[model samples]
Target: MATSNRPNAPELDSACVAAYDHAVRQGVFDDSDVAEQLALGEAEVLRIRTVLTDLRLLIRGEDGSATVPASPEIAEAELSAHLEAGIIERREQLARIHRQMRSLAPVYRAHRHLPQASQSVRLVEDPAAVRRELAAATRACTSEAFTVQPGGGRSPEALNEAIARDTTMLKRGVTMRILYQHTVRANLATRTYTRKVTELGAEVRTAEEIYERLIIFDRSLAFVPQERVGGRPPGAAIVTDETIVGHLWRMHDKMWQSASPYDPRDVDYASTSEEIKASILRLMATGLKDDVIARKLGMATRTCRRYMAGIMDELGATSRFQAGVRATSLGMVKPDPNP
Candidate 1:
């Protein structure tokens, strides 16, 4: 391969990234190792080989075995150079998009001024409005209700309130399913409520990370958070659109099947934290921001950050990404079977 640094070199694809990351850790890996480790096909391996070679990350051997390796430090420097070139190109595109947004601002404003009844979506601001919307949706649920509640644990008052609503819904023959983080398994109040609902015909499960807070009613109505306007109070959306509501319901259905069944004995379970750690490792490996991970685990941002610091310290990592990479190489976590 030419040693020239060419501007036209292709950007690294996901396979190439995996191979590169593997190489950085293992120092070298032959064709079979790369294929087996990354689960890549022949064509993908070929592409990854070409990209790694062009980036000066791997040196081909005459026998197609025992390729010479590049030090990770040097490879990372080269990676930075390649990324800088790509960023320069993308920045121009972003600037043009921003200009277009400026041009369309007035049109957006005009639509915003339209009467609320005209839109199929209902935007509820303020805590009371959100609660009312949710209550109304739950009451109207005829067949099933699925909810993803991402947060550590509910307060006694909050759990009582939720139990009252959920118990009624369950008794009315509405099948209730809720998704929670493993952390909630340790919360006494939450577990108590979880047990009560499960006995009342509600199915509860937990996952490592949840996407967002949502409630889907009878596969017809769905409620989701609305992005808050600048300095405005937080709010949510009551989605009535068939396409959107169906999508949300399907999402909940998939996550429901993936999550572990809520076990009563799991209260004070040490393995639950391990599961949460594995999820954090997986999410960290993919470069999710801390706040995003916190929301998924239903934990406070501060708590999440502290937990990561502890993990990184234990791993002797110099940075968060390095901690993630080390954890990945160690197989500290397996991919969630359903996700």
Candidate 2:
């Protein structure tokens, strides 16, 4: 019989391979008998035969009937040769594509020297462009990456994406240090992500509050969101100036020193809760509302109100104003001079 030329033939699944085995054991190929013994439908039996034939595991007679199963040694050698040939063809195809793309590398480099790209500070307003630049910067990062994420917990999808990106960097031996709001310690998904990355030698910590979201790569390049304004789309600033990047790096290091190490099992919730309450009292003393305080501390307004009620009860104060005054007297919070 002529060999099949279909290099991309369908693979033989378990059911089809089982049917082939039954035929080999019977010393004769009989589709109807095989179907009866295997409890397979006629269509399924036909499919098995087709796959076997395409895989060159079944020998067919001139009448196009499956007559004998190929010997194991002969079948393995034929399949191995076919697979190796396919692999070689794929490698050659990939090489050709790589060569074609390689020819355009110089053109890309030339365009990279455009004013905006070479600027020390670039305002990237397009979200997609920001993501592309971030990915490029991440790939180029060699020594270390530090990031501050100022929310309670990231969504699972976002964490999954971050884990994949960070895993690649960790595998490349990049030192990673991430800081998050202390609220993340209460999040199961965030804790799981922290555990996985910490196992890979990354450090994670949490603070009562973080100023803003920032990502610095190798103390050279930094990405920061633009100062938020109502009615404007979000944008990021890419900083490449040595002095500014150095200052940002030092700020991050200072924050890192102040943050507590994140251990899911060993978290000092009491200490963390006290710190959060103190932050809330400080904000309250400045005449901030509950929602504003919640926004700053990465908690819901309802939760923030509940915390405020508890604080008032502890301070024996009836109103937020009285609570702030009493807290100041107790030296729990400093007086807001401007207020």
| Best model number under lDDT | 2
Quote each prediction's TM-score: 0.57, 0.72
Q: Write the per-residue lDDT of candidate 2 for residues 305-332, one digit (tens) a residue.
A: 9999999999999999999999888899
Off by over 4 Å in 2: 1-53, 57-74, 93-106, 112-118, 140-143, 171-173, 230-233, 265-268, 286-292, 334-339
* lDDT score for residue 17 of model 2: 79
Show where candidate 1 strays beyond 4 Å. 1-119, 228-233, 286-292, 309-322, 333-339
Clashing residue pairs, backbone N/CA/C < 3 A, model 2? none
Query: What's model 1's lDDT at 100?
Result: 97
Prediction 1 global C-alpha lDDT: 0.79
lDDT of 1 at 101: 83
lDDT against true structure, model 2: 0.85
Local distance difference test scores for all models? 0.79, 0.85
